[model samples]
Target: MRGLVTFEGGEGAGKTSQIRRLAQRLTEQGETVVLTREPGGSVGAELIRELILGGTGQFDPLAEALLFAAARADHVRKKIKPAIESGSIVLCDRFYDSTKAYQGAGSTVPAGVIAQLTQIAAGDSRPDITFILDIDPKIGIARAGRRNLASSVSADRFEIEGLEFHKRVREGFLAIAAAEPDRCVVIDASRDVDDVASQIWLALEAAKPRFMRNAPQIRLDPKTDALVDDFAQAMKAKLLASQVKYGCSDDWLVDDWEGECQAELANHVQKGDPRDVANYAAFCWGRGWRASPAA
Candidate 1:
């Protein structure tokens, strides 16, 4: 089941760390996870990230909102949408909610304008769940500053903003969470890292089943279906040939092999990992399929 999970908060709210932890957990459960960030993710969006984050006071509030929306449009179309279609759970660092918080509340941009831009850019790719890592603006800023200094990375445009700006951003996120209780989970990020992560995981565990149940069924393109079918036939042939080669095979061995092959093919196709299907085909075509010692 593919899901779009987003993390939103003020600066240094531990979004990166928590996102990684969640991704690892999901991956361990055999989910295909795509970790990405907004203002970036796609190539064009990344260029916009460099332009927007690298420059200070270059864009007015409305312009900044527009820039973010433009980047988000590219990101959704190029990266987020494709990954979801391919059955990958996309864990995003930020999404349009950042535009609503930073550009709308933290700046002079109107909420209506921000919403319009977000809808246009994001289309139907709304997040399945959003984690608002709430923290005091001052503490978050200090943490961001220390992180930048330690990594020898200069403060980006928003990181350089004053305390009042960050405070507004924090409030913005909180307001969003309150407005959309069903979609958002506000995590108290001031707690210990493990505590915060535990809260997040618990919330995710509770919500994931519902999201998966509501997720659209996996649909394969004609080309992909054809590829899967071809691989299925080829794998069956290879397994039968191997059984014949090893003359001591039981009469039902080839039937068992075919059933197993079909099961694997169904699993791979349902997961929508075309690469896995191709790799399986390659494995069966190579010497590995026939190099086994007699059993």
Candidate 2:
């Protein structure tokens, strides 16, 4: 029953409580669950976590992003990778999407660069499923304040942030969920804990069996790579031809290619062709405006 599931949201989204509940239920089902969180799951990572969260360092957004990447690299090497390799069902309170929301889309950092940093940190390892808890920023902020007032710990940098920041983070999370619908599930955190947990359980029950029964690390052969390359090139060429057909400018691109992209990825995924799936994902990820230095 080896797999990884991550819960992500703004502060006061009840991610911690919901994750704990899910972990307890799964453990009772006789699964070995490795419950953890980021940016500090491993010991070394915890040190970094304190430096970031405790506000001792008070680093800028970019520096904080780098620190997070470092901590995540260590966490993956020391804890997450090992647990999953041992066939444990790993439930994480937060993961890469936190960085993506807080530091990337919600901040000044380029989302592409953050995406690259994440790739470097975790390699090809990605969460098998991610749950994004959606809630109103106003209610969420008040809830977080009350939590801080009640708990032993005070509000850290992120929790101390203003309403606008929380709103942006929520939008960032929603964007991620929209971009990767298959890999992410968005639940309305405004609902009561029981209802949210029930929805989460339904999602888990549907997906866990597939992961446990058939999850395997896929490696593509040279022939498969070539075929995928051809397919990708063909897609690109078709898009280019479409531009010519429509008499578009050189800098112009499709306004809404996501539907086609999603359909293609879903096709490969449904066919259970891992090589094709990997290729399709890689191609789709490279979509949108690419960086090009001007002369």
RMSD of each: 9.5, 13.6
Q: Tens-digit lDDT track for model 1 on 1-295?
A: 5779999999999999999998898888777899999889999999999999999978999998999999999999999989987778899999999999999899999999998998999999989999999999889999999999999999999999999999999899999999999999999999999999999999987675445333443345777887776865565555556545654334323333333333444345445355554554353333123232346
Q: For residues 63-141, could you state the per-residue lDDT of candidate 2 as single tens digits?
A: 9999999999999999999898876888998999999999987787888889999999988678988999999989888
Worst 10 residues of 2 by lDDT: 286-295
Question: The CA-based lDDT of model 2 is what?
Answer: 0.79
The count of residue-pair clashes in candidate 1 stands at 0
Q: What is the lDDT of residue 265 in candidate 1?
A: 40
Which stretches of candidate 1 lie above 4 Å from their native place?
Answer: 213-295
For this target, which candidate reaches the highest lDDT against the unseen true structure? 1
Full-model lDDT for every candidate = 0.81, 0.79
